[model samples]
Every structure is written in C-alpha cells, then in structure tokens.
Target: MVISPQEEPSPLLREDDRETAVQRLQEAYADERVSHEEMEERLDQVLTAKTHSELASALASLPGENPDTTSTIAAAGGRIHRGGTWRVPRILKVESAYGRVDLDLSRAVIEHPAVDIELQLGTGGAKITVPRDAIVEVEGLHTGWKDLRYKPPRRARSGGPRIRISGAMGFGRLKIRHARR
Candidate 1:
C-alpha cells in the first residue's frame, strides 16, 4: 500500500505556497536569522518555485509559518497607510471604499520577489512607492472617469522584486512611483 516517490502525486506549487514561504522568510529576517542578501535570495527562490519541494526548501531552514496568517487591510471611508519598515506580505489585499490607501515599500522589507497586490478601490486613491530597482506591473485595473497613472518600469532586472498589482479602481487613482532615494 505504500507509494513510491515517483508514483506519488507531486504537489504543485501554488500562490499560497509561495506566500507562506515568503512569510517565513520575513519572520526569519525580523528575528535576525537571515541577512538581507540571504533573504532576497530565498525570496527569489520562493517566487520562482515550480514544485512543492522547491517551495518547502525555500523555508526549510527557517521556522514554520503560522497556519492562520492574515495580511489584509480594509479601509472604509478612511485612510490606511503602510510604510516605513513594515513587512510586505507575499500577497497583500487592500480594500478601500471612499478612502485612501498608501503603501510605501521604499524602506520596507519585502519577502517575495514577485508580490501580488489585490486592491479594491472605490472613489478613493492609492499611492504605492517602491524601490527604483524594483519592477512594477499593473493589471486588471479598470478605472471609470478617473486616472491610474504610474511610470512603468523599463524592464525587469535580475535580483529585483516584481510587484504584480491586480484590482479594480473605480473613480479612484492609483499611482506607482519610485522612491526618492
């Protein structure tokens, strides 16, 4: 009744798996268990992981992640700002209704090389700041009578994080800019 490794079904790496690995790396970075360069390298591996084994290897040296991890911010008729040394989750979901949401990743600690941001903006604005070397990709954003402006990255460079933003912005503007540094 035992299944061989080849006969067993291989676990496909999913977005959630990548997120969990990144979260573990973030915690390790916070606990000083991994240096900045090591964190970045591990994050890259996590994002580009193709199989469950690869994903597991990314966080194998780190502590286990919380099974019930949540990294979502909802702003209803108010302002929500995330900046300054905050840990960037692997998949950050922001929901705003008649409010503003600002995310500054200039000095923030990013755990994933490819971060996915799910935004639901309504009659509100969002300003996101990332490092100059990072890559910003916006998708699935449809605005009505409003503007979503941002200087797209020239090209994806090696060893730089890629921010994949996907959401709907209604009558709200979303601006992505590079850090002043």
Candidate 2:
C-alpha cells in the first residue's frame, strides 16, 4: 500500500528505523563514498531528521538502495494489501502484529527464478495468491495456533519462479492458492 506523505501519522520513524538508517549510513561510510567530515555531517542529519523527507534526503546520495533490493512490508495494527502490476523484489519480508495481510502476485513481475518470503504475523492471517505457474514452498513456516492451508495447481509448470515462505504465525491461519486463469 502506498501512503502519501501528508497522510502519514508522524513523519518521524521509530527507534528501530533510525537504527537501521544509521547502519546504512555506516555502510556507506565504509564504502568510502565521502570524506570523514561529510560522513559525520550526513550522520548528524539522519540522527536529527524530524520528518520522513528530511531523513530520505540525508541518504539521497548513498548508492545502496535499489528497486531490486529486499523490500519489507510492515504494519502494526493495520491491513497490508498488495496487488495489481508491481515489481517483485528478490526477497520480501512481511510483518504485522494485529492486521491481516493479502498479497496478490499473480500479475506481479517476477524477475528472479527464486523468491524468498519471510513472514512475521501475530494474531493475524494471510492469504497469498501466486501465479498459476509458480511453485510455492511453506515447509519452513511454523504456526502457533492453526495450520496453514495451501492448494496448488493441478498441473505445475516447470521453470517457473519458486516462492519460498518461512516464518512464524501466532493464532492465525494462512491460506495459499493459485490465481485463477
């Protein structure tokens, strides 16, 4: 889901988010992109950023993030729904606490032959719809309350992308199915 900058509750991110940003900045420093003084200045900006835009600008020159990078979808009590035509990253991390998740990847552009999905849900269920030719594997997932239900296609297509899902679900059930033709 895309959230406009104005619709955001608070532009300030959580402590963990700041920590991650700091780590990224440190990585950039290690890459020798800037002098020590410039790195320190950018770190200060990141640490003192008051809004999302400010923080983003602090790391705008960094050459780390890209479209194919691992993307994380997180929610704290809200729903996460993704569908339509979108670029599928190599690795996806889906996280939620009390909200449901729905991912429709039938029409998504899967560039890689293998994709990894790591789920972290608490008291919420998820429904994933994969392409008709994709192969899914959920053997590494663990559920606290209920088991997962996944229905595969009758005729599996070889050479398709492999979706590997692994994670823990608390008091929730996961349902996976292939998209209808």
Best by lDDT: 2
- Tens-digit per-residue lDDT, 29-127, candidate 2: 788766688889988987897765566567665655454688999999889987643457899999999989999876455678888989999988999
Error of 2 at 132 (Å): 0.2
Residue 144 of model 1 has an lDDT of: 73
Stretches of candidate 1 above 4 Å error? 1-70, 153-157
Best by TM-score: 2
Tell me each candidate's TM-score.
0.61, 0.63
* Ten contiguous residues with the weakest lDDT in model 1: 1-10
Superposed on all Cα atoms, the candidates' RMSDs to the truth, in angstroms, are 13.3, 10.7
For candidate 1, write residues 33-64 as lDDT tens digits.
88899999999988887765555556654544
Clashing pairs in 1: none
Model 1 TM-score, all chains together: 0.61
